[model samples]
Target: MRQQQPAPQAATGTTAGLANAGSKKARPSVWKEYVKTRYLFLLLAPVLIWYAIFAYGPIYGIQLAFKQYQIMDGISGSPWVGFDNFKYLFEASPDFWKVLSNTLRLSLYHIVFGFPAPIILALLFNEIRFNAFKRITQTLTYLPHFLSWVVLSGILFIILSPSTGVVNFLMQKVGIEPIYFLGNGHYFRFTLVVSSIWKEVGWGTIIYLAALASIDPQQYEAAIMDGASRWKQTLHITLPGLLPAIAIMFILRIGGILDAGFDQVLNLYTPGVYSVADIIDTYVYRMGLTQMQFSLTTAVGLFKNVIAFALVLMTNFFVKRAGQEGLL
Candidate 1:
């Protein structure tokens, strides 16, 4: 015999009913908040509009990379030429390898020598016993950061002049020949790297100084109580505390590996050192603006940006995996 079906229970709520209930709940409105703070929004409106117009707006022109662009035709009207621009850069450009190598080598040198100098300076400054001397030294070092590369380059050129420069004069005292610093390709890259370090090292120290300030005094005191020397305390407590900031800054540096300081290179380099000093930015400026190869220049710029984005993502991933704060 078949059993009789039980009577259906009364519905507490259907899916539509629950959704209606959710919609009807007294919740805060985003528009209401904006209206309440209308004055604040009004103040921010100009900055938002400025960024939309100038900063983010120009991204649309990236299409020029895939097109044969002309000033008369404009971006939208330019004829699309697909991958021809990229093909020309890799296959046809004569200075492609040399410029690429120079850029990479210079960046690597900066990372190797330049990155550590600031950290060491900051640590040394932190260890100074006299406030007056510390302030004087900091002021002297930081003054160079304000000088434009053009002015600084001129100063460097005057100092390194083979005939009458102070550097050559000093070399003569040591009975050694005056080296042709700017004329020689072998020394040009080294000069650029060292000069860049000198110019920016003090400015870079500012960040490390800030990071060092955030380190706890109690940690250092504890180390000292354990009979640790100042150097040991710095190594164990201070350096470890600064690691997160260093890692974040390093990730940012890695992201911009292609950007090996365009302004400095432009000011310091001449035809003699082009093989060792020319970088992608200078190359693009010459090719697109001077030679009128707009499409090819855009392609190179796009490639650099793509690589930068990839580097940032990869570095951030490794940072996260290593249990450290990342640039993201």
Candidate 2:
């Protein structure tokens, strides 16, 4: 047997070949696997179709940004203009700059004040040991979120009206002049910020409250044993526990910095506050639908979206670099 034994290299090669052949035979084809999971694909089909139709479908219309967009010619037949619309936005339109500035300022106000409102509310809610009072307070807060912005705007108009509003009546009784909250450009941004926070704070707080509930109770007990006050525990433990959720939310907010609440602004704003309240979305609405400047409107929208997308990417990168999970 020794005299006629195969070489060690040959024997090893044979064994390896046989093993690879066995693996090849054992592995299922992609078609077979797809067939096996056909039911799951069927269940997911509607969502995929919906996104394909509504979400991704609109991406094809981005051509309108770079084209003259003759309605009679349609998207594909429109003549190429090669950045003329963008040039008009950057150079020709004075209103564009004002609109951009207003959008940025409004969004910044929301970030600075409105962003933290929910966190504060959630923390305050957490400290409330009375379950009934907590539930009622939470319900009262979140109920405004379910109301349409139209209804909320109508309520706000009555409440913030300089002459007949309950707020103005109170001010008059206190010997103070009634302020035009919604009408004056000087106060319009402030009104927008305050109204927005009031409308959405409760719904936003629900996320943070859920995050708070997920923190280990044992950590709090240990902190209490170590003579930690509620504030100390919150600063050291609770804040750290909520950091991931906060970072994710912050990144999302940064991504939408240009949006500035289109529906709310449209419903609440008048020509008196146009200088302070005319955001990109409202401008887009006017140009596209009212003025029929379809190409220019498309260019502006594309610009806003590109900037927002970049902001999201940069924010997410910094968040992860700082050792917190972000919305990727």
Candidate 3:
């Protein structure tokens, strides 16, 4: 006869056994994981709680953008106005457009002038053979980052004053006009960009310098052995090594195109220079807090964040298509 057929029950049991063995996977113990990393979790708990309370918790109030917010009636109780707020921003208000333009111009100026400063500084620092001098210079540059905008603004006011200021005094000696750097709109914008660079460039340099440290030292040694000049080495090796970090920072910077330094602008800007200096953040501050137009300001804020989000995605996509790794 043919090979004896297994009993139907035996075959079923064998099939079930195979299925169970194949489908079942050994899972690591959750309790063991908790026991092993309990301290790390404890350290992270505060950050999670703060983000939950301050960042994500307020997200529920985003509906305020859609509603005509009333103090007596809360976010949920407020009557929904739908797209009216957005219409007011894009169609009705002239001021909104002005602020939007200012924000974009300032942000673009920042990317053009400010973005490269750190990279250049880091490269120069890398070339420095004198460690002590490099450290001292780096420390001096970084000190401005620690100062608050309020204090810095006061210092700026003194330095930029048309009369009785060091800058004006020096200009007078050179037979140049005592330009009101803080009062005139164009000069104010220039001051804002330059001051912003001064305050943050050092910190940004630290980031690029850290990125530089990870580069292989052997490449430089080999380049020296090959008789490559310093410029040639930087061009072929250093910059190529920095490309990934540069691309990452560029994407992040593009995403915040609307943010344009709220604290710095607010502190340094005056009513005289509002035409050029007022950015989206300061405009929102005036409209929301000063004019009590909460819903409109919220709508504007929401719009800005959406545009920023889209920009980030688009930038990352382009960056990847250019044959380099992207932020994502």
Candidate 4:
């Protein structure tokens, strides 16, 4: 009797129709998305394949860390030794602490000296009004970044050679003795840090420059209207704008605290400087490959990864608590 209660069948039909409509809304258009972005998917196929082959594929072998790996027995057939490998790492390994200390010190040196370099370069470059000159300077700085560590190490050797190198030649002109930078343990760490900065600072600046580009021009103009100088504007506006990017990069750098520039260190290091030069990666290489202590080295690697992961989490937590955005 009320508003058209009609037949029970009619009401059921209306309810069914509403249910169908609700069902349609709830259903995801996953297939439709694939069809619409099929070209983009095709473009991404190679990268997916690359990760599958080179990155994710090796995860299966991580079990080797817990097992006594035998070449004849293979990874799967290797007998599990449980925590023995890890025990060896902590209790028995002679140079474990030394290597760990070297790794941390090198990483700290890179972060302390290397991290701010690109930011400084970016700031200086941003102030340059001449586009052509800025581009030339940027290009010159960036060229070294593209060079391989092998090539760069060779270049360093040639330049720092005590007898024939130009650096030593200049030292002689200044009435100073030619110093073997790469060979002498006293200067090896210093050389490593400085060379690393030279090779990487230019490339690292690209991120900061990109961050700088997105900063609002109006902020600078407003600052100018308020009698702010360029220095004041940069200090107040530019750095604040760049803080998010800096925080993110810093978090990432902390995640790699154990890495310590493997390629650069490996290429530049010699037996003479191994005490100071040997990092986690080189130590693992020597133990695992050179000495055939696979299980021991794998345990060391696992320990490093755990610490790095913890550092990343801790860093992100502090960064977020400080009222800045973090990588998490």
Candidate 5:
């Protein structure tokens, strides 16, 4: 009976071949899967193309930071200047330190005052049981966010005008002297912060409100059953629930510590308030685009980007180390 039996190796090979054939038949090809979702792919193609052309395409021009860029020579033919532009910025440019200081100080002021404003507004909005009133308040607050800084700055001029301004009129009635809010160096930074918060707080609160809505109603009910007051519930439950969202926003804000609202500052600032209102971005604009110090502007921009990137990384690390969620 054992005579002429197939060799053991031959039997094993046959079984292995059958198993591989089954797998080949079962597995779906990636290309086939893509073809199956071709409609989605078609819809996504334009966005992918847009990013490729606008966002990634400009990366090649970053080399201008190290080159003596000439309009005739163009980017490719421009002579390389290495780190001279950056060295000049740090050592040679007298305004660099002052602009840098203003940027940092303004950013710090925003973080201290601006960051908490939205959260507080959101919390206040959440406490309002009257839906109609709440909605109207939210709409009023968020409307400012859509306005161009040019328009807002014009409005500010009208409201803060020394002679005809509504604010000055009110101050005169209260026996206080008419103070030039925008023109005065001492008041310019404060006006920037207040105006920024006023414009953005409503929009920012929308995010926090969304986060608040996601917190379990049962937790609040249970807390009330345990005899907790509204303040206690907010302090213990609401704030803790908001920590994840707060951490994410904080990390993003840290990345913008060098920005200091270029549009707002540009539109609102004057020669009288330049010491307080000038920032890295405005300085870069005046130096690079206006003054045509192309290489130096590029270097300043590069330096700003590097510092921002480092700040984001460091901030994310600290946030995660503190057991909170981060943007990354």
Candidate 6:
């Protein structure tokens, strides 16, 4: 070192240059690593394209909510009316209150009675010892879900027909008057909820069944060894395990509180039950297609979507705060 140290400056410069050169080389390799995932991206390309074309593409039409849409001008060229559509829906339409009330009542009834039915069915199915019987019952119940609302409505119409219906025949044997299930305003919402529950309960039970399947068998054995009753085990282990699934489903249901089964209602309802059966979706459909009020329909749809988005967010917030699995 005393004789001929090449020069401390040269040594430091070489180290610095090598470090810089290494980083420069590393950057391209990192980029190449990213580019190598092109096949994975190609797999997702169709879904991305679908959303762009169908989901996000249609969102551009939302601007019609603020405009007075004309056939000649179309969406972009239509004259801006500045909330006139919303004003009309809120102030001018008397059907607004009736339809909204019907929608809320139907949804509330479904939540109260319909929501728990699948859980109950799932629990009951879990207790069945005969595998073949269980499979047959499940198949029969789920078959109705595959039927279109139009077909189901037609079937219901015949079954509930006062003149020759099986239901009326049974009622007559019991000395009770034949009730007009489809024609009466008072029974429309009730029938709708019942029919919906009957059609959907089986399909809904699939999720709960999956959740039940995931429960550790060892826990049940331990509970049995501890002298825990069947009901006690269900209440403690089964129900608690199912709670996360239930919470997630509940949040999804709340998100679509305004839905109220539009296709079923539209197919089953007549003018006689319009006051109690007409929901937001059916009303929007009537306004848009039948009445040709495109702007009002768009505004109503936008309002419904916004409300749904907010409801989902709020429900998810509460779920997370309560230490449950959330949609996020």
Off by over 4 Å in 5: 1-31
lDDT of 6 by residue, 103-221 (tens): 88889999999999999999999989899999999999899999999999999999999889999999999999999999998788888989999999999999999999999999999
Listed in order, each prediction's TM-score against the native is: 0.88, 0.90, 0.91, 0.91, 0.91, 0.89
Candidate 1 lDDT over residue span 84-143, tens digit each: 888888998898877888889989999998888998999999999899999999998898
RMSD of 4: 3.9
Report lDDT (CA) for all predictions.
0.89, 0.95, 0.93, 0.92, 0.94, 0.93
Give residue 56's lDDT in candidate 1 (0 to 100): 94
lDDT of 1 at 257: 93
Clash count of each predicted structure: 0, 0, 0, 0, 0, 0
Clash pairs, model 3 backbone: none
For candidate 3, write residues 218-301 as lDDT tens digits: 999999999999999999999999999999999999999999999999998888998898899999999999899999999998
Clashing pairs in 4: none
The alpha-carbon lDDT assigned to residue 9 of candidate 2 equals: 100
Runs of candidate 2 with Cα error greater than 4 angstroms are 1-41
Worst 10 residues of 6 by lDDT: 25-34
**Residue 138, model 6: Cα distance from true site in angstroms:** 1.3
**What lDDT score goes with residue 293 in model 2?**
93
Tens-digit per-residue lDDT, 1-328, candidate 2? 4578898999999999999999999999999999999999999999999999999999999999999999899999999999999999999997999999999999999999999999999999999999999999999999989998899989999998999999999999999999999999898999889988998999999889999999999999999999999999999999999999999999999999999999999999998889889999999999999999999999998999999999999999999999999887
lDDT of 4 by residue, 77-177 (tens): 99999999988888888888898899999999999999999999999999999999999999999999999999999999999999999999999999999
| TM-score of predicted structure 3 | 0.91
Worst 10 residues of 1 by lDDT: 6-15
